[model samples]
Target: MNAEGLRERWATLTRCVCDGARLMVGQGNYDTYVAHIRKTHPDQQPMTPTEFFRERQNARFGVGGRGGFRCC
Candidate 1:
């Protein structure tokens, strides 16, 4: 286990943990979303990070315009 090998393994583990955490939350998967847009709608562009975050937040909390889970 050299320094370089240890660094690579740590980076990989960090990436996996971050990805898993993202999935656990309501935030959408950026890579998968981009791939889907490229495959399905090649002409259209994908949402930017800010736009995507707002969209996800809106979907989860229904803050923007659309309605989400309501506990009335």
Candidate 2:
């Protein structure tokens, strides 16, 4: 393969690795959520990143009196 082909392949691999890492760490759901909103709720605007993070945190930790069971 040519040098340009190698560089392209390397870039693609690097991107995939980074995306996989983000997904493993729960930080990559924002894109998926945005896509879902666009597809399922075309009339509704998607939440901003900060808003989305807060919402996810609240859902996971039961913030604001939502009563998520705390083991600790």
Candidate 3:
């Protein structure tokens, strides 16, 4: 492969690794979400980064100000 192709592959690999690490730590990958939304729901709007983060946090944890995991 050419230098450019090798660099692209390296970059893609690096992004995947970083994304996986973020997931492991309970963080969201906004770019990936946006890409998926754009590809699958072109007519819909994507959330802003802050909104996306909040949405993800609420989905993972509990929504109310109560606390962490909810069992109801």
Candidate 4:
């Protein structure tokens, strides 16, 4: 959905009929948000020091994908 569609839906959910909190829960939708979180973590076997260093070097840094530049 577009930004307007998302905002419209958020508005609807946040408006209450009897003065109760419209945004009742912290998350907008339980299943959609939870499933999103579950999709990001990958399963792998534990790594040795050398292997761990290799993987760590390859991983992105900062908030997203800026990348790691320092050595241990």
Best by lDDT: 3
Off by over 4 Å in 4: 21-72
Q: Estimate each model's TM-score.
A: 0.66, 0.59, 0.65, 0.24
Q: How far does residue 60 in candidate 1 sit from its true spot (Å)? A: 3.1
Candidates 1 and 4, the one with greater lDDT: 1
Q: What's the lDDT for all of these models?
A: 0.83, 0.81, 0.85, 0.46
Please, what are the lDDT tens digits per residue for candidate 1 over residues 1-72?
Answer: 999999999999998888888766668778888899999999999998888878876787777657875557
Alpha-carbon lDDT of model 4: 0.46
**Steric overlap count per candidate:** 0, 0, 0, 1
Candidate 1 local distance difference test against the native: 0.83
Each prediction's RMSD over C-alphas, in Å, is: 2.8, 3.2, 3.9, 14.5
Residues 1-72, candidate 4: write the lDDT tens digits: 999999998887665432243123211333333455557544533455465444444542322455544334
**Candidate 2 has what TM-score?**
0.59
Query: Model 3 — TM-score against the truth?
Result: 0.65
What is the per-residue lDDT of model 2 for residues 1-72, given as tens digits with 9 covering 90 to 100? 999999999999998898888655445568889999999999999999999987766665678888654667
Error of 2 at 18 (Å): 1.3
User: Could you tell me which residue pairs clash in candidate 2?
Assistant: none
1-72 per-residue lDDT for model 3 (tens digits): 899999999999999999998787566799989999999999999999999988777866767663656768
